[model samples]
Target: MDMTPLLLAEIQFLASFSFLALFMALALALSWMLLFFKLRVRLTGDAGWTAAYRFWVRIFALCFALALAACLPVLAQLGSLWGGLMDKIGNVAGPLLGYAVLSVFVLKSCFLGVMLFGQRRVSDTVHTLSVFMVALGLLLATAWMAAVHSWMQTPDGVAMVDGRYQVYDWFQVIFNPSFGWSLSLTVLGAALAASFLIMGVTALQALRRPPGDGERCAFKTALIVAVLASLLQALAASGMGDVISRYQPVKAATLAGYWHSGDEPELILLGWPDAATQTNRVLLAIHDTGGRWLGHDSKGYLGLDKFTGPRPPVALSFWLLRVSALLALMMSVASVLTLMRTLRRRMDLAALGLFWRKVLVGMSFSGSLLVVLGWCVSLVGLLPYAVNRSINLSDVFSQATSSTLLLSIAGYTALYVVLIAAFLGMLLHAVRYGVVPVRKTTGGAA
Candidate 1:
């Protein structure tokens, strides 16, 4: 299909929100984890824990602010760029959107303020409560949006009422078939991203400051979290892929390039899927897990061949799946080894050599990349139809004007670049300047 005006609009909107959501999810995850640590430290009354908490709070605040700023435009674009989609599903989505903005966002922002500034203003218990509330608000906000996406993927309990979709049962909409798996993947991905970010920031701090007890504490925490999250991420991803296999066969098939639905479907770990020829040239093929991977039947499995309609871009989906899996495995090994070395008492946080420290720094963004790749696979795998077998891209954006489409795309791209750069620049400044100067007399946080 050519790049039509509506298609351009769709791409621009997806790109903008995808970038924003990745960082925001990370922030939400970090916010909760940090707050939990902060609560523990408050009770322990350890200066090391206090310093670490203070330092991370700064980074969390930065991500929260940037993510919030980027989110506004996407919300606006839902109406401006894709009004037709809203118009079709307005009755259902409108209420959810309202709740997110008015209830969740409002509560999140209010509690975040308390978490950040209430340390001195409120009692210790109240401050901790504020942190808990902020985390809860963020979680609820994400859940609401995830519900919307789940409905789109596996729409149920909705019917046409006066030519507009009406919710017959809200429970089905919220707890759709894909809801649990999608939420699990999202939460795990967020944790994965946040852990990497924490590791990255702490590593940078090590470059400027002598390893104080607080710095060591933070580094240890980040390392432990990253390692655990990576392992969990691997499992979560497999479960998520399995969910797709059961609910969305076409997407599942495209993911593994399992084009022909038959017994013993070949699992293509690496390949170039050529759709015109309906053949995937495999680099590594495995038949052992094909049936278990895609189905429970005695036969290998049923997948793409079960569907007669047009399939999504198998090459694109396959490539994304492999790349994501590669990054995930790389992070998993790096994290596990690092943890093992620490656990064996072979290497202390302060004693990690420059080589390993640099490696950790490079892998700090792996979580973000992993999540982005997963999103690409899912979104692309649901191709040809924006709302799965029903509503489509062309149907929604047919009214878009071709003349201004390119301009809109450029506008979103340029702004997102600036937003992302600002986010990174903030982190860079924090890394350079946020470290407390070590003193034997008194080691206060920066």
Candidate 2:
């Protein structure tokens, strides 16, 4: 069935999250793959899969690059529809986005060319430099886009001027309210994802190949790195709890379901989300959640003033927070377990194997969950602030028909599904074929 406007908005939120997760997963996999290749080469004096890794990495990076390009139009339309501070980033984002896309493409071309044609010794060095360049580009692009997105949750320092907005400070625009913590959390999350993939591959390799001392040590190291990265990511998210609560109480409350703003909020565990009925089947609630876990406080609850009627039901935020947190924690445990198993080198691989199996399953589920979370947070986060803005007379896309909208929606759905399928297919192929191409290096390496 075709989705309604509300449903479509939800889907857009879900789609953005889905895209972000895919982008992050691909990026994480690519980063650790490079690191693994580097370590192996340094230790054993073999470039191994560096060439194939670059090929896949470039393809993956290009996908996100294009996805960001596509978001430009979507953000523009959203800005026109919402107006006010909503458009601030979109206005500035166009040129910045253009520069980013061109930069990524250029980096990809440089890496692809070097990997394909450069001599053995030079190729490794050139490939390493190219990958570093791409990493830098990704860091910048993710930060910029995240700033634009997180701004929607806690808009600040924007003044209305005769039905238009006059942004007073450029730094403030970029900084927004939750700028620092949000950016940090995203970067940490990306790093965690990268480490997880690396260790995951390491673990898989160890399982398939007979246990040798060298292989066991390598697996242990990868798992430790992944575990460390995952822990830091959790801490980063926790550090931002105050920001989510104060600047985004609805999100906080939705995440944890704390009612009637006060000194301490309890954290909820598992629950069925009946947002329509405004009731969460609370499985567990922690005690004494206090002021400004990230920054904002009781005043953060006040930010809900931007909403029109009764505010969004608290249940929505309640369920989302619990689910996202649970998945993150489960993944963390799996990483730690993998690390422990690899270290013992006892060859009793059943436990670690189960953990890897869970991860693969969890990874599949996380795709949709993250998509839903992204959409919910982005869309609902905007409503409170936009309600205070001047109204536009016509709908943003008046020229577009229902048919056009459907076609647009359907096309995106198909493309992303195919993109996801292709990515998973490649991942499984890597498992089957290993990182080093079985065939001798060919001209088509690019």
Candidate 3:
């Protein structure tokens, strides 16, 4: 095989999946935030909270729309690019995908309309319940999708027979060893991303005009949420490290840049991995940390040499994991600093200096960036296998010509670029101008 077409197909699928995942995280985070805002409105009866809800709802709608739009390419690619994968794992994967899709549809058709458009017609309590339902729907959808991907990572409860995977236990399949950790990390990542997005937009709004009560409330709330989410995300990442190391040691070794099995492996802080030589050139690292991190002792750790199967692209996995870790650290620092400033200034956005404001704005999308990078690491690290050790990419990759693959990639790239631009344009416009006041129509004959 030339490998060109397969490479192109991988690129196309990755691009599409990354786009979808980013928007999905945004939408999921925003949905929960909306519920919180709605509850604040009901309890405090503050007009500012209402203003905050109105402002953010627009962004949520935009994110949800883009998420849906992004889904089509991913679904299309399942058949168009990796048709053979379905032949092997469809019994396990098909129902999970359907559940994810159905959850979204149920939310949109039932609760989303009430949450979005029924705010005026329904009572405050009713509207709040609708928001809660919508949030639950989003959570369920995320869980199902995470279950599908996590199963691919661990692949339990399935017996291979006649070239197909059949589920022997639904419980094990749904809650595969990695599923809980994956879901926790994903949801926390979304919350963190959404918090930063709110902080950044609020800061932008403050910079544009005099800071309002609604803006202060939103900024403070998001700051608090960011702090909590970042802390929880760190813990979740640590837990996920255990899962990955246990189930996917090769990926763990690649991510840690470990070449030889030992109790204490050097943690590569900065290096370039050369697979051809199986060494790290231009190395900068610290030793004696891997044992503690991997929860191993006395030469219990397995390294890259322990695996004779196909290895992932070493440099890509190594750097992506490091970059994501660096981003998480930066976000933690930023969150703490913002919290201190918020406490000192008492939610006064105007008191925050321009430098800090710019930092917030720059990091507004950091959560989304972290999510994408994390997904890239997960997918890339699982390379050559569509389903762990069972189905290799060579077996499932499309037979499409390189030209056709290239054309589809180009088309998807263009489409995503436009969608992203539109999202940014609309979001900036909304933040700058703020929401327009709608006239409450009263005394209508029902």
Candidate 4:
């Protein structure tokens, strides 16, 4: 197979997946936030909570719709661009994919309408329950998808028979070694991202008008969630390193920038991995920390040279890991600082200075940015193999012509660009108009 076409196909799939992941994260987080707002409305009957729900629901609806739309290309690509992957692992992949689709369809079709449009017609408790069901559906869908991808990263409970993987234990396959960490990280990342978006939007709204009760409630909630999620995400990330070291040492070494096997592996804080020379250039590192972090402890780990098989791209994985870590640190710091200020000063949106507000707006999408980079690190670190040590990507890539692959890539790119632009434009318009006034009936129904 020509590398040109194969690379193009990989790029195409990645492009589609990135778009899907972004909206999926937002949708999942927003669904739960919507539930929270509805629960508050039910418990307190505050019109402010009603206003918050009404405003945020529109954003959630847009995100959920885009997420659903994004799934189409990704699913299509499995059969169209990487049919061999399904051919080899269809026994494992098929059921997971079906479960994800079924969960989304059943939850959305059955309850999403009632949650979004039937709020007035139904009782408050019923509406709140419907919102819970919708959120549960999103959670299940994310778990199934994460299971499938995590299995690819660290395949388990499957035996290779005549060049194809066959599942023997469903539980082992679904709860693979990395599934827990992967799911936790993904969910936390989504929550953190959505929280920042809320903070930024709330701040923006505050700047435009006198800070309302709804804005203050949203800002406070987002700040608290962001603080918790970022801390949890960091811990989950550290634990994930142990999994990578245990199952994929080469990837671990690549991320740690360990070029040579030694008793003491230094943690490269800042450096350029020069593969040609097999050494880090302009190095700034902490000696012995890498060994501990990679779970080697006293026992030294294998370097790139020690791996007999093909190795992942060292520079790509190294820098992506570094950049993502930096981004996560920034998010953590910002969230913690903002949170401290709120606690000490009882700061509302109006009390937040102009500089801080602009900063919030700028960092609103930081969580989404981290999510994309984290995905890149995981996928790139698994280079040369489509399913751990079992299937090579070369074997799975479709034997399409380069020109054809390029054309499809162009088409997908254009479509996503337009869709993203439209989403942002509409989101901005919603923000500009601020919250829609909630009307109350004579019977005290919103």
- TM-score against native, each model: 0.91, 0.74, 0.96, 0.96
Return the clash pairs for model 1, or none: 264-300
lDDT of 3 by residue, 1-39 (tens): 355988888888999999999999999999999888888
What do the candidate models score in CA lDDT, each in turn?
0.75, 0.52, 0.87, 0.87
lDDT of 2 by residue, 134-170 (tens): 5666666666666655555555655656544456765
lDDT of 1 by residue, 149-215 (tens): 7778778779867656889899888898888878877887888788777776666677667666666
lDDT of 1: 0.75
Instruction: Tell me model 2's lDDT, rounded to 2 decimals.
Output: 0.52
Model 1 CA lDDT for position 443: 34
lDDT of 4 by residue, 1-446 (tens): 35588788888888889889999999999999888887887788886787788889989999999999999999999899888889899999999989999999999889999987886677767778899999999999999999999999999999999888899999999999999999999999899889999999888877788778888877877888899999999899988988998888888888888877867677888999998888888468887667755535354667776678787889989999999999999999999888766776565677778888889999989998888888889988898789987798989887899889888988988999999899889988988886566453435545
Residue pairs with colliding backbones in model 2 are 13-375, 14-371, 18-371, 242-293, 242-294, 254-317, 254-318, 255-317, 255-321
**Predicted structure 2, TM vs. truth:** 0.74
Better of 1 and 4 by lDDT: 4
Ranking, TM-score, top scorer first: 4, 3, 1, 2
Poorest stretch of ten by lDDT in candidate 3: 437-446
| Candidate 1 segments whose C-alpha is farther than 4 A from its true place | 295-300, 346-348, 401-403, 435-446
